[model samples]
Target: MNQHDFLIALLVFLVAAVVAVPLARRLGLGAVLGYLIAGAAIGPFALRLVTNVESILHFSEFGVVMMMFVIGLELEPRKLKNLKKSIFGYGSTQLAACALVLGVLAALLGAPWQVALVAGLGLALSSTAIAFATLAERNLMSTPAGAASFGILLFQDIAAIPMIALLPLLAADAVGAVPHGPPAWQTAGKAVAVMALLVVVGRYLVRPVLRFIARTDMREMFTAFALLLVVGIALMMDAVGVSMALGTFVAGVLLADSEYRHALEADIEPFKGLLLGLFFMAVGMSIDFGVLAQAPGQVLGLVAGFVVVKTLILALLARRFGIARGQWLLFGLLISQGGEFAFVVFGVAAHAGLLPPHMEALLVLVVALSMVATPLLLLVFDRLIAPRLHALSRRKDDAIPPQHNPVLIAGFGRFGQIVGRLLYSQGITATILDHDPDQIEFLKGFGFKVFYGDATRVDLLEAAGAGTAKILVVAIEGMEDSLALIDRVRARFPHLKIYARARHVSHVYQLKDRGVEIFEREMFEGSLMMGRRVLEGLGIDPADARSVALRFRRHNIQAIDRFYPHYRDQTKLVSLARQARDELEEMFRQDREQRQKQEDAEWS
Candidate 1:
């Protein structure tokens, strides 16, 4: 197609989407659903205003690829490692179970073993985008059910690779001819090798390359490299006749460890988003609205079938995993539909002779309808399902408010714990805010008093009695986040006194400027402790050693006051601060010696 045609197609999709998404959101539905509806409405079946949608779909296919790449950027190797149990344990089970159930159902419905198997797998996987976004929007991402849902989604991602690998194998073409699009073994082997290469490169090569690019300080270069990595990998896979989604996901996993992961992710994010919207629109355009009109019962029947079948499987699975009964139902209801892969598998299988054309068209409608239904469907869980679960949970286990304490602790990590324990012996009742459902979940065993929430958020802080608390002790770690929280608290609860921990002098200044009454540099105590012990061991009297320690603290405080302004700028870094401290230490030595000599002369 020419540039003009491309621009016109884009305008149609965008204009439709811009209008549709707001309407969906305003109706308490998701924008994804809106985009799908927009696509369908502007499509051949409706206005027939847009043509060449198949080409647009092909072009927009890269959106899925980009989404996978961005998904890869967000994941960390360490986090992946921690989720190994969930990935293998819960993930493996859910995939196998769902696939088996769906496969059996397909076979019963008269599909061949291979087609049925693929269909089952396609039906088993849930929408990660919908599940996560809805969870986050409703503020349930931090909840147990939310965490469990996340674990399952992580498994689905890993599962997609194998499914993609299996697609060609399931084809009926002869091994010798361009017959089934290459032999099954050849296809599988290439997929394995490509994956292996990504692991090796991502682990060994990506970091240094990123560092090299970073040194050049060219954003366009980095973006170019990022896009190039995705496109290159995708093309490589495509050349080998593998799925591009598989290639892009591999690219992500490989670049997962690059310290430049976030920057690369940020750079690629806009492209991914645009591409994904286009892809969804293409999916929308692919829908056979005419087929639905001809065989409304068949199309809707399959959708209902898929939802009922998948929902039952998911609920049973959730229950088996020991999620509370109510959440189990919610989980089941949330995931029971054909996923994004259904579009690919449906198109490919129909073309590959696995499914009859009529059946394929029916399934395509089912998949499209399912995608559109996702956002509204999740509202069932978020609104009706979740509240009922919470109500049940409340009835099963109730809570009582803790007595007030002067000091309120938000996190009981190493930082908050020390303050809480110290205050505990003094008969203090410290109210702590900790929103990690995992930690709060186990708090009962430890007999620790903590609540779940982001302290920077007003409701959470209010729950912790920020208004009534005499002192707010911020023992939270991390420089940037802590500063942000300090600023937030200072703005909302101005009268509260804050004592915050700083990992360095800069952190000290950051907290101090926020009006924190006490900001202890994290490393200062170690230095002070060392100096005190040395003085005591050097035969200094206990009382005089204490005096010396106080005198040293006074000098250190004075030095900080003098140098902090410049230190705030990178012009006075750690080395500069050390140099300034050395000069102050030398002056102290001279002052001590002069005072001793004057005392001796007076005695004489």
Candidate 2:
């Protein structure tokens, strides 16, 4: 395209993305689907705003490569090794099972065996971009379902290389001709040799070069090197006919132990996000709407049929693998769509004559439509299904034995434990209630008496002697929970004095609103102590440091009290805070001058 056309295309893409992504997210569909929808609307089949879909898609596939590299950076060699069971066990089983079932279904539908096999393999792969995006967006990447999904996707990326290699053999068989490529053994050897070369280069060469670049302290240069590394690896992998993503992923893992890993990730992230978004849009643009129009029922049926089959298979695998019951359907639906690799696979198959043109077009539409359907399906599941499952899965509150201790602690975590221990040391025992069963069991092993129950529940609070207890300690970790417990105790047991833990200044205001006079901002005293020590380290007299800390604490407490009435007004709150800071500084300056005068008098 010419410069003008390129600029126009960029403008259209940016405008579409800006308009579509937020709307999709506002509607709870997600940004991936938004990009896809934007692509489809401006694509040739729709608005005809852009016609060169293939070139854009080819360039944007590097986004997948970059994403894999970033993901690999998170998995150290040890962690990757730890995932062997999931990668090979669950991953291998899932791929084999899905391929077998889908391939059989294809053959049963009268597709030639070669075409059927290729189709099954292509469709068995799930969209890594979509799955990872959803998982990361939901912050589920650390969950069991996320780990399992990653393992499956990682395996699929690795497996796609061989699948691509298999195309020639399959094509040759289909056409009753001898295979034209180098011998299978030679190809395998070359792949192995290339991987070994990468390992050697990454371990010996890449780190030193990165170290040299980092010493220059040019952030842009570091970013440039990071991109150069990925691009170079991709080119090398493509030359060897290996999956560029897999190659870059290995490079990332090799650098996982490097100090530059975070820097590399930070540098590469923007490129990855943009490219991945572009990749999704390209998938959207590539959707063969003409093929859909030609055979709508067949196309829609294939999309629905394959998705249901894949989801059921994945759900069963999740159960077998002992993924959380609540996440079983989630794990399935998150990855059931035909992946981006399918586009490449089917395209290759068509070129090699393994798949006929009409069938290839149909398969492409099926994959794209399935990609479009995933976010919608997940939105429905999240809105309708997940809440009910969560409700059913919630553990019942543990029974609390009757207690009459003078002190009732709502949470026995770090903050409450210190209070409880201090009270116990003084021969005063408090009744402690915590909701975390694991913590309670562990603490019980240390001979501490603790009950497992949500303290916000009035019944549990009463059972823990909140009504008769002289003091109720609201030390729950969650701000909302602490506030709720304070409200409940104040309402139910008005005679009880409450000592709450405030997480921050906002929390202090909230506690004050609830009439919690004995509350402590959790970090205030410790921070003051640290500040005093820091002053001493800076050559200030010890006595002066202590006085300064004490004075600062008193000033802060007075400031909090003054700020309370205006807490609901952000403008007033900020203004008062700034004014208080200046006043405190002035007070400190005067104290310093007074101390100097006192020293002068003593010396005289």
Candidate 3:
């Protein structure tokens, strides 16, 4: 197609997406499927609105790269450190098992050993984008199943580096030619060096540059810098024969601890979303129905067999790992689809003459079909299967009535444990529900009764005696879970008084909005203690500092209520905050003056 034709095609794609995505979302099918269906409709087989699919596909692959970068941004270094074991253990096992199983099946179906291995490795990868999106949408990203799924995805991304390097070797053997590239050790050395350089640059050079740009207060320029960083790292990785996605992901990990992490995510999000939508559409466009029509049974059978096998494997793993039934089912269905990386792997193989055109097309078709089917599968699980399972679980739970404990603590973290310990010292028995199995085990060793379940779930709350508990102490680490649990408690058992913890000003606002009159900011008291120490260091009397802290605390509490109403309106909130600050300073100054005058009078 000419330049004008390309422009026309772009307009058509944008228009179709704009119309189809919202309609699809309204109909309960996600935007991914919407883009896919739209692509298919406008593809050569149907409306023939845009015929040059290859060029678009090639350009849109960067969307997947951008996606990896964004995913890395969400994974902070601390969270990754906590998840190291799962990432290596479950992730490595999933890859090895899936490859072995699928490789053997491919060999049995007449593929050569090399080809079978490539196919197995390629198809073993699950779609990270779809799986994470599904989990995040349902607010399950903190659950065990979600963590496991994320770990496996991270491993797949890491595994892609070696797989890319291995592809040419597979191709070389297939075509009986010497591999015309750097030796493996040299490539490994280069990759390590490049990664180290990226880390250094990100930590030392990039941050300062970002800070300088931030100081200028130019939002657009800072956003440009973010893009430049991602694209520059991508180019460097590509230059060294590494995957661009891997490069950007590594860059993202390095930047995860930066103060600008959230800002970078916000800036890159729109580009990521649009490009990813285009990438999905390109996949849909590449699905040649003509090829499928030639071997309908073979195509359909392969897709079904792959999904069933992967789902069964993931289900068994999740079950053995003690994932909850509802979460495991959702996890299995969400991750059974082949990933976008498969497109890269298959394209590399096909270019190397390792796969025949027909086989490559068939595999691509299977991957796309699996991706398209994921949302539908999730909808089925959510609507049809989940309700019956919940009912059964609830009935079974009802058989064991928890011992009567007047106080129920939803979390057993540092915050909740302190409350539990204090109550224990007073001889008040408290029931604790914590989802962290490790924490529950530790607390059990300490002779505390802690149940392993999500506190936000109503059934678990019922099992914990929320119906009879006199007070609920919500010290859950996550603000969302705390708020959700509070909402449920207020609706179901209004009589139970709630003492909640707020992580920040925004969280405090949310709690106040929810009628939680007795919530404490998690850091407020500690900050007040620090303020007292600072006052003492400045040579103020200990008693005076203590009095000042008390007064400040009371006034801050009152200010919270006044400021919360305008929280959503930035202008009004800023104005109110300034007014509150000035008023507090004036009051404190007046009190100091009164104390000085009284001291002078007493001396006279």
Candidate 4:
């Protein structure tokens, strides 16, 4: 409570985090486990140095908020659209199925229905932060299995909204207790109003506010304004008793159109990392080691049950849903754990008379142990399941049209296919530069020109297209290499107005620094183009359609001017971008509506 204790707690947390995280990661585990181990080590069970206190949880709560904010930043409309089937279908089904199966088992074991439901939901989901970070670190996110795992995680995150609402109702004392804090109806009403406000502001207001902020050209003010938006919205959402996580998600989704979305993500990232670490540590602290020591068998059994139950369910579900066997196996194994929200739900249940404290403590241990062991189970999937699937997947490729373009495309195994095929139709000559020399030469005898070269190298760039008198479309693979190519090409070939691909907003900044004009990222093509087409498809004339798109384009282009510079800073970017998106979207909406109204009146 005092400054001395606060500083000590801070030091202990920072020191524990710094030490434990890298150690776990080096051992092929994730930071979540490190934080848990760190917390446990420093608790009375080990070091007995930092006394657990109420302030610790409050301090760690900020981490959860920051993490959620970043998560919100990443939940851009375009990315979410790409993940629609996985998030809504696989993710939804996995959570529900896991919860139902676990709930039934718990109920059969003499647990009350309410406690069983709450406990089951706790064990049904995996940690998104851990799974994603670990997979990305291993460069496996692009794999089908990896993507499937991600979809389920993203869906679980979105599902947090309904879970929050459901928690109170699941509490047996829900009808009696809620009258103390604003009436339940009032809380529900405020939540609805806040969400409605987010939609309206996101739809009609965000863009113009950003445009106005742009006109001012005050960079510091803009960043401040962005953070203000995140905190303000987060605060308002918290005030209405909605989880700040869900609020930030909604805000992030709404601001997907804003130029500052990526900037906001980068800015908010570090704080999210720290605070989220704290949140995980707090979750770890909640685990009753005493209960575990007393009933190690029961604790370990609960964890094993989740491993077996969730894996079987997810495996069968993935198979029935037509996921590749390897992918199905991966999906099953990866999701065989509980999530952080288990602690939140359990605490609420205990408070609401839904769960006995002794039982609640046991559930906490189960969730903690499951989370701690998650990364290891992933190793099982990778070592045992994935390779088998890869081997089996060979036969299925028989039906796949063979790669026709001789240009050995490295990344295009997906994105590069279009460019390669269009060139094929044009009868243009090319050779592919890929890291896999074997794959390259294997296709070479098949009447395709394939070669092995690191595309980022100047020699490789030249070999691909630097001086052979043809265009170089620098879709040369990863963001780093792609941006490196942009820089290299700019200096080498002043004549080439480079069309560099931007993977994220950070990549956009790097390209922009090289004065790249035709920069394309996934979102630009995926949603922006789709929106323009939808308008035209609705019988809107080409002129109006182009004008509408042009207006958004110009606004976004200008907004990018601000977003690019503030890429690494989080606090200010969130507030400013949120405001800018609010302002700009409204101005554009009003202008478009006014024109439409005039056209309607004329027709009348």
Worst lDDT 10-window in candidate 4? 396-405
lDDT of 2 by residue, 370-427 (tens): 9999998999898999899977876788777888999988898899999998998999
* TM-score, cand. 4: 0.63
The global C-alpha lDDT for each of the candidates, from Candidate 1 onward, is 0.74, 0.91, 0.85, 0.71
TM-score of each candidate structure, all chains considered together: 0.66, 0.91, 0.71, 0.63
* Overall local distance difference test of candidate 3: 0.85
Off by over 4 Å in 2: 412-430, 434-454, 523-551, 587-604
* Model 4, global lDDT: 0.71
Give the distance in Å from residue 419's predicted Cα in candidate 4 to where it truly belongs. Answer: 14
The lowest-lDDT stretch of 10 consecutive residues in candidate 2 is: 390-399
Best by TM-score: 2
Descending-TM-score candidate ranking:
2, 3, 1, 4
Model 2 pairs whose backbones collide: none
lDDT of 3 by residue, 505-558 (tens): 899888988998887778889999999999999999999999999999999988
Candidate 3 at 132: error in angstroms? 2.6
List model 1 lDDT by residue over 1-604, tens digit each: 6899778876887899899888988987776777788888888888887867777777877886787677666667676676666667887888888889888988998887866876787777776655654565567655656667767776786677556656555673423325445666776688788878877887788778888998998989999998888888888878766667656766786677767888988988899777777766776777888898998887788788888777787788886666767677767765565666666676777776677787777766777777666676776667777787776555221132643667888666776777887888788888887645656677657766777666667656765678788888887766776887788888888878888877886677666677665877767877887888898999866766777778778877887777766765776666667886788788778868976997899999
Residue 594 in candidate 2, Cα distance off native in Å: 8.4
A best-first ranking of the candidates according to their lDDT comes to 2, 3, 1, 4
Q: How far in Å is the alpha carbon of 428 misplaced in model 4? A: 14
